[model samples]
Target: MFCKAFRVKSHTALKSSDRKKLRGDISSTFPSLTTEKLAELMPPKEDLTIAKVFVHKGDAVSIYVHNRNPIIFELARNFYPTVYTLWRHPDLLPVFTTWPPVFERMSGGADLMLPGILMSSFGLPEVQQGTLCAITLVGNRAPVAIGVATMSTKDMLASGMKGKGFNILHTYKDQLWAYGDESCPPNIPPEEIEVAPSANLEEGYLDSESPAYITELENLHLEEVSATVQQESGEIKLSTETFQEEKAEIPYVENCNTSLQETMDDLLHQCFFHALKYKVKKSDLPLLTSAFLRNFLFACCPEGQQVDIKKSSYKKLSKFLQAMQQRNILQVKELSKGVESIVEIQWKHPDVISFVAPETVLPLETCETSDGGRKQPYQPPEILSLYGINAKMLPLFQASGHRKGDLLTANDVRSVIITYVKTNELVHSDNKNFVTVDPVICDCLLNASEKHDLLLLKWDDLVTRCLERMQPSHRVAFPGSSPVVRKGNIEAIDISVAQRGSNKKVTIIKNLELYGLDPVSVGSLLQQRVQASFSCTVLPGTKDRVQVQIQGNQVSQTGKLLLEHFKIPRKYINGLDLAGKAGKKK
Candidate 1:
């Protein structure tokens, strides 16, 4: 749940009474923790702070932070240890081991699948549904993730290990880990050593009772399996045979530089096409080359791979772009001295048309992990649509040196209307709250009914009428970019309940792209959080425009996600009132 950054609602030092109670709660939550260990984890003199925070999905949690690391969190009145707590005490909870690749996927916000788990002769640990557990990587005992069991051990075995094993709540390298000093998980060895998994078992099969398996390896122990298995300095040494087998799988590299250069070039092309296809939007055109490379290209590089232009054949990003330009892929122009921007891209170029993206590209949301992780998703600049001075109001605005079509915010409109009233001496002497209706006020700020019924109007009513008479317009501005003034209101995120088939309801959300949200990422997040299936499809007749369809009536969840997590203004969200009591019940 904390994979996303949370907003700290309140932070305060822990009281003495609360400290003692917290220690007791920790002791009770994990019976494995001893008094001494608990004391070390939570010292009396060390100032602990209770941080009441809310995650993107609107869940309120209280976290106990020590040395800037969140050690424990309280959710729904139950206490759970953070990965920091598990790092110091590795054996505090039952751990399910998985492959290293699976850990990266989990950190990217995926549940632990049963097939990815590594099992031993002793079989999986016994845990009931909702029982909290830790996840470790193969050959290392350090816990990398924290989750809860999706089903009982008996149910997992009954299903033949074919579905989601755990619902991962937090993982290493996620926002929760970014909350602390961002330390990596230290390698820790298991207390007891098990024999290396056999080739068949590594392929995800366990035939323990088979006659052939029993005859080949019965009652196998580490020493009996191979004399090469040994313990040195508290670390287990793998069997020589196993080491040789793994070594054989790796291809030999003749020269390190040649291999590195080829790898870097591959990364460049992969990220280049990936960025143009998914990252760049028409609104982001005339994008700076440096910003494109630093923000988009590098972000698309696969995990554990760094993109270095110097290592590639081009030796420079500009050279690579020059090569692409020669191939008719895109055009670059130097708009200012010593600075270049990508002017145009040929969308129908064969290279662009046939560029199939990789299945796993690092999402831009968590791409800033190399830097300090973001506290929340990217918030597009706030755009406001308000009244503009029109032909009818031009005569009144001329005295204030305002143009005929100047855009005005609510406050600006009020200020101008008030100034006009005061300058014309339209305020009634007896009642200062009212303004006398003159010819200009009648033409520009009065309705037919008000003009016929009264000679005077309330100050607020006059301002409201003046604003209603103005033209509609919008303003958009962000750091380092020119402000844009348009004549129409910006489109809001559209959400509506639609019937898929007979009696089947689905929530259709569109216009998220306008707000810098990826339709696929948002759909995946909701699918995991709501435990519902979702699909994304391009809008017909529109290229690059997509909509997300989620099963069931999930209007409330969608609203909270957009409003709280993404920091979107309520005014920019449409159809929230459609989230009836039924949606809340879900």
Candidate 2:
């Protein structure tokens, strides 16, 4: 169901009470989960977000995201586990195993057909219709898909294991999984992978064209049955260790001399040079080391390939880049204490000059820098602090046809007062700037001193007093959402420098959630930009609001990130002057 992209309706941090309720709900729903296991899934200290989304078919789904991965989602009040959640606890639900090749079809939104299932001698797990279940590959225990049973085990066997088995909702490579870190399924070994029974010779089973395929499957099933029968009769014996080792054999390089580590190092260097030759441009210089690796180097990798630095001899991107620097391929500079950048590149260097550009390069989009191009993240609507019409200002607003509780900007307030004066013909004929103060205006917009003596007021004075008499409020309107009016002033993004321990200084930022900036994402971006260590902590007396703490004084960088990257107005951000003299001001 989640194969296509979905629209996010609302993303908000789940309240503590709601979180507790959800935990209880999940515990009751999945009774096998213990208190400790549930705590691990939904950590108390971590931020849990409940995102309301509309799928392609306009079905509303409430997804609970933890650590950027959607663990659970609710559709029609029915909770379903995500593939991410099933990975850790594979046996949480009744599992059905299928051939590896069937996953490609399932990822494309196809249902799990009985023909595709690898039936074991023990038969399928007994499940009622609409019971949530997990699907795993033939040899791997890690679940790659989740769905509800379309029929019970009795019905499935009664029908000779034909027709649909499970209605696949979310799959490994679907849009739901893309919402996460996009980590591949782990290679978890299955306890007992079985072959399908050959009794039901359904036509077009597994889309097989040749009879040999069906014959081979039946032979495999028979072989297993024969072996089991022989073992029971003491006619043959099998070594458990050898059998497990064969089943768990990971496909590595056939050559014994070459290690996987060496292969990874070669792959990293190949990708690095490929990026330099075909991807990296001169404008991209002064690129952050982290960005260079994540954006440029990784994008240059061939399709279906990945570079794992941990497996390489260099072990780190910095070490790999340092080795490249030694080879005169690029100049790595530590512009800041920990932050490193590729300030210059040797385009004419022997290695770069001799590198051949591939005819077909992966069409991967890299993030645009401020100079290279504009790559903006999803920014929330600009917050506007305005006046809300209260009971005191209701009389004046009513004269202009504005109801109470109507939020108005300064210009809006002035316009309303002017409209009221003109409609009442209270403007002085001699001087248009002066307005005859009516009883309603006198009561709502005037103080005791001004009301007792002054009958006529200047237009500006009338407007100013009208604003002062109104209650303070703010409005926030996210895209595709209605404007929300809240009481009191909006909290500003607060940045301050505090001394940690004796000598260490740290920059602390808070109130980011109010502005739609995720503290975790912001801190990660800041860490990459400044090459500093950072941490996110939930603020006390707040509804799961996070505060970002970074090493050293990062007032300048933090301000720039909010101003440039997030496009937040300076008025909404505090501590600009605290950024020191070198900080950019606008």
Assess the local accuracy of residue 364 in candidate 2 as a C-alpha lDDT between 0 and 100. 26
How does model 2 fare in lDDT?
A: 0.73
Q: Please give, for residues 1-586, the per-residue lDDT of candidate 2 as tens digits.
A: 8877665555667889999999999999999999998998999997887877778788999999986689999998878889889888888999887654456567766777775665665667889998988988655678889888988989987876656778889988787887665666766665743444544333323322223444575555433432110122211222223333443353311113455577778778888898888888998888889888766786666543457786689988899889989888899999889999999998888888798856544522122222212233354575777999888878887767789778889888878777788888999999988999889988887778888888899988877777777889998875544778788889899999999898999999998867766665577566655667676665777645778888889898898778865678888989877774655834
Where does the lowest 10-residue lDDT sum fall in candidate 2? 226-235
Instruction: Compute the lDDT of residue 466 as modeled in candidate 1.
Output: 79
Whole-structure CA lDDT of model 1: 0.73
Model 1 clash pairs are none
Q: Candidate 2, TM-score vs. the true structure?
A: 0.56
Candidate 2 residue pairs in backbone clash: none
Q: Which candidate number would show the highest TM-score if scored against the true structure?
A: 2
Q: Could you give candidate 1's per-residue lDDT for residues 257-364 as a string of tens digits?
A: 245467778889999998888888878888889878866786676643446686689998899999999999889999989999999988778887789887766633
lDDT for 50 in candidate 1 is: 77
